[model samples]
Target: MYVLIVGAGQVGKMIASNLEDSHDVAVVDRDSETAEDLTYEYDVLSVEGDGTELETLREAGLEKADLVVASTDSDETNIVVCGTAKTASDAFTIARVRRRTLLNTWEGTQGAFGVDFMVCTDLLVAQTIFRISGFPRAQDVETFAGGLVRMAEFEIGPQSPLVGERVEDVDEYDSMTFAGVFRGDEMIVARGDTVFCADDRIVVIGSPTSVKEFAMANVPETTSSAEDVVVVGGSEIGYQAAREFEAHGFEPRLIERDHDRARELAEALPKTFVMESDATDTEFLDREHIDEADIVIAALESDEKNLLVSLLARRVGVDRTVAIIENTEYTDLFETVGVDVAINPREETAEEIVRFTRTNQTEKIAMLEHDRAEVIEVELGPDSALTGRRIADSAADLPDCVVIGAISRRGDLVTPRGTTVLEAGDHVVLFVDAAVLDEVSTVL
Candidate 1:
C-alpha cells in the first residue's frame, strides 16, 4: 500500500512512522526543515510544499497514492488538502480536525468535504477522558466489540491488594483475560504464573462488567465509578468532557476563568455547574470544595496549564486527576509528576486514522503505552489460519507476544480460553506486541 500523509506534525509523523515499516509512505510539509527531518527520521519520501495546492499534491505522488491523510494543524487546510487529493486521486482521504462541529457537519453529509473519514481531536480526547473517568484507577480504557468487550490498563499501586498475587490467584473474574503487562520498558505476556508487581501496568480485556469487577477487587475505593467530576477548563475539550459526563447522568462541575465562556457553557450544558474562576486559584478551589471531588479533569489548551491544574487538584486532595496533554512527549512526565492519567489528543487522533489504513478486516484498534503494544479487533474470514482451529492450537503457531483477549460471535461476548474454538465471522480481539503487530495482523 502507498500512503501519503500531508503534514509533518506529531500526528502525521506518528502515522508515517507506523506505516513506513509495512507500506510505502510519503509525507508533505510546507516547512523545508520538517520535510528534511521526516526524510531522515523514517523510511519515507518527503515533499516540501503546501499540501493544499494541487501542484504540491502531484509532487508528493498523490496520483498513485492508495490513501491520503490530511493532518495539518489547520482544520481548513486539512479539509482543502483532502478535497484537492480527492479531485486528482482515487485514494481514500482522511481529515484530522480539532473541531467537533466540522465532524458533525461531515457526518450529517457523508463525504461532504471529500474526506472518506474525519477524526476530531478534541472530541476524541474528551471521549477518552470520559472513558477513563469510569474506571477511576485505570491508566487507559477502551471499549471494543460494540461496547461489549472492554480493554483497560491499570497501574498497580504499591498499596494495591493484588501487589503480590499471581495472575492465577487473581483470576477470579470469569470473563476477564490478563492480556499483558508493561514493566518499565519491557513487555511481558501475561501467564498464569505471572505475579502482579507494583508499578506494573497490566492490560486486561473482557466483558465490561467483568473488567469493572476486577478493578473493584484490587482498588475498591479508588476503582468505583467516579461521580463527583470537576473539569478545569472551558476549552472545547473540557466543555465536551463536561457534556459527556452530563449526558451519562453525572452533574459535573466545570471551572472556567472567562465569565462569558462560563456563561456560555452554563447555557450549553444545563446540567453542568459552570463556575467563573481560575482553576489554579487555591482559594476558589477550596471554597468550591474541589478537594472532595471524585475526579478532577484538566483540559486546558496549554500543556503547562493542564499540568499545573492537575498538580493543584492533587494537592487539594482530589481522588484522581485526568489531564489533556497536547504534547506527546509530556505524557510520561505528566503521569510521573503525579497526574493519574494523561490524555494525548494527537496520539488518539493518529490511532483512529491509522485503523483505516489496514488492508485486512480489522474492526477496531486501541494503541497502548505509546504504541509499544496494541489491542485490535478483527473479524475472521474463511481463509484465516485460526478460523477452524482451537485458540490453543492456533496460538502455538503464532508468536508468544500475541494473546487472544476476547471474541464476539453473532453479538455475544465470548471469553477466550485455550480450549475455545475459533470460527469464521467471529470478531477476535487480541493484544499484540507492536513488534509483531504486522506479522500477527497478516495471519489473523
Candidate 2:
C-alpha cells in the first residue's frame, strides 16, 4: 500500500515510520528543512510545500496513494488537507483533530469535511490517562467498542491476596474473568487449572463495572491508592496526564524548565504543584524528594529528555516511571533502558487513526507488541465460518496468517485447546503479524 502523510511533524513522522516498513510512504510539510531532515533520516519521499494546497498534494502523488493522513499541528490545515485529498484522489483520508468539541460530534462532520476518519489526539491521550487513573493499581486499561469490554493489567505484588490461588478457585466479583498471566517473558493464556503466583502480571477482561468490582474485591485497598506522583514536563500531554492523576486523588508535582509555562500550568491546574526545574538534573530531583514519589512520569516532548529523566527517576528507586517518547524509532531502546512504560504520542495517535479507519472490520481493543509481532482483537460475526468449530478444525481452516489468542463466549473467556469449540456469538482475539491483516480478515 502507498500512503501520503501531511505535516512531517511527530505524529505524521510516526505514522510514516510505522507504515514505511511495509508501505510506500510520502511525507509533505511546509518547512523544507524539516521535510529534508525526515526524508534523509527515514528514506521517505519528501515533498516540500503547503499540504493544504491541491498542487502540493498532487505533486506528492496522492492519486496513487491508498491513504492520505493529515497530521499537521494546525486543525484547519488538517481539515483542508483531507478535503483536498478527497477531492483530488478520492483516497481514504484521516485528519488529526485536537479540540474536544470536534470529537464529541465527529460523525456529523465526517461526510461534510470529506474525511474518512478523524483522529483526536487530545481525546485519545485524555481517555488513556483517564482509564489508567481509574484503576491506579492496574498498569494499563484498554477498552474496546465504547467501553462495552475492557482489558486491564495488574501486577501481583507481595501484598496481593491472590498470590497463591488457583485460577478456578480465585475469588472475583461476579462479572470478571481472568484472561491471561505474564510471568517473566512468557504469556500464559490461563486455564481452569493454572495457578497464580506472586509477582505475576495478570490481564483481565470483562465489562467495565464488573472489572472494577472484581479488582476492588480481589486486590487490597492500599494497592489502588494514589498518594503522590511527580510529573516531569509541562507539555500539553504532560498537563493532561497530571490532570488525570489529580482527578484520581493523586498529588501531582509538575517540573518544567520554562518558568512562565510552569506558572501557567500551575494557574490552570490549581491542585497540582508546578515547579520550574530541569528534569534531567539529578541534584534537583533529589532536592525535590522525587525518590519518595510513588510514580514519576516524564512527558517531555523530546525523546532524549524523557529517557534521561526516566533513567534518573529509576535510579532514584521510583516505583513506576513512564516516559512520553515522540519518536517511534527509540521504542525498543527505551524498553532496554529500563523505562517502566514508554508513551509514544505519535504511535498512539496512529493507532487511533488506524482503529477508526478499520472500525468496520474489527474492534481494536488493545495493541501489544512482542519480539517482532502485534496482537489485536476482532469480534466474530455469527455468520462467520470459523464459529462453532473446534480449535483443531478451525486451525486448519484459518489462514496461516492468524493465531487465535482466546475466545470469549457468553461471559466466559476460554483459552481454546483442541477440543474447545468456538460459538457463534464468540469474540475471538488474535495475535498475528500486522503484515497479514488483510488475509486474516478474509478468514474471519
lDDT of 1 at 215: 86
Task: Report RMSD for candidate 1.
Answer: 1.1
Give lDDT: candidate 2, residue 304. Answer: 89
Write model 1 residue lDDT over 168-226, tens digit each, in one string: 98888889999999999999999999998898999999998888888887863664689
Top candidate when judged by lDDT against the true structure: 1
lDDT of 2 by residue, 1-444 (tens): 678999888777767766666567899999979988987788689999999898998899988988899998888888889988888787888889877556556676547578888877755775575576556566567865445566777767667778778888883444455666778766666666778888687777666776777677665542453467788888877888787777767668999899899989999888899999897788988898889877777888788888888888989878667777766678768966777666666667877665543435476736554212344566777767787888789877665545565566676666546687787767766655555655666777
Q: What's model 1's lDDT at 293?
A: 94
Best by TM-score: 1
Give the C-alpha lDDT of model 2.
Answer: 0.73
